[model samples]
Target: MDKSSYAGSPADKRLRRILDSNVGLCREDAIWALDYIRKKVADGAPAMQGLPQPRLMKNYQSFAEAAMSLLLSQRSGPMEAERLRKMLREALHGLIPD
Candidate 1:
């Protein structure tokens, strides 16, 4: 819930903006993901390696957007549900040290 911790990356700032403007389950999920990432960072999870920061953040943004869209959709079949899960996993993985 602390915005300061998320101020380091453009994608983080964008996500904070989205969280500030939205009022629903997607916002809640973002909050939870942010908290989880923060905790992971605090617990000394290794920073992401290999990928450039911008590229990693961009990927996270895309996955997050897809996941949010799926979450907001009222009608999702099993495949769509699985895709959402994958997006969320990828997004979280990318966000840990952003």
Candidate 2:
């Protein structure tokens, strides 16, 4: 996975904090960011047009998003956790263009 894109970053730290603190669900923007990356990967499009395609981009995106969702959803109880997990999975799946 592209840990480089996430590791030691303030955003990642903040995400961790949110999860550890048992905060509410993730904001829509975070979900959208993950979903957008998934779509790009599914289409085999450049993550950024001017940049070269990343090796294992799809795997990286999937892992990162799922990890983030898993952590963030921990704040909720089992029922809510399952709900959000499914939502995140569906959002990831929705990235595929019909």
Candidate 3:
């Protein structure tokens, strides 16, 4: 994949950081979600509105699981992609906690 295709822009990184902090998705999943959410924003739907509301349940485990699965399902050969998959796997194994 092109670096730009998966690489987060500055804004994407910022948003990803927030997701990592609050939603607690690992970097791999969080960044993927950043890309996904950015695409959603471009398609006229922001993932999060600034409305203050009660916290709803978020499934960080599933998010990370799905993101890693998607990455692996791509059958990528790049070292970075493989490295990222390992990182996500580690995170899923509780290497990194929210």
Question: In terms of lDDT, which candidate is strongest?
Answer: 1
The count of backbone overlaps in candidate 1 is 0
Across 1-98, the per-residue lDDT of candidate 3 in tens digits comes to: 22333335664554334333223334455465535543543574433232123311122344455466665665534544445444443333221222
Model 1 misplaced regions, further than 4 Å: 1-35, 38-46, 49-51, 94-98
Name the candidate that leads on TM-score. 1
RMSD of every prediction: 10.7, 10.3, 13.2
lDDT of 2: 0.47
Candidate 2, after superposition: displacement of residue 50 in Å? 9.9
lDDT of 2 by residue, 1-98 (tens): 23343345564444333333243445553454465555666786542343433534544665575657656654646556445544444433323221
- Give the residue spans of candidate 2 off by over 4 A: 1-26, 47-62, 65-72, 76-98
Pairing residues by index, what is the TM-score of model 2? 0.31
lDDT of 3: 0.41
Query: Residue 82 lDDT in model 3?
Result: 48
How well does each candidate superpose onto the true structure, as a TM-score?
A: 0.39, 0.31, 0.23
Give the least accurate 10-residue stretch of model 2, judged by summed lDDT. Answer: 89-98
List model 1 lDDT by residue over 1-98, tens digit each. Answer: 55564575675565544444232334355445555555654675555455578866865685667646655876545555445445555666645342
Cα lDDT for residue 38, model 3?
37
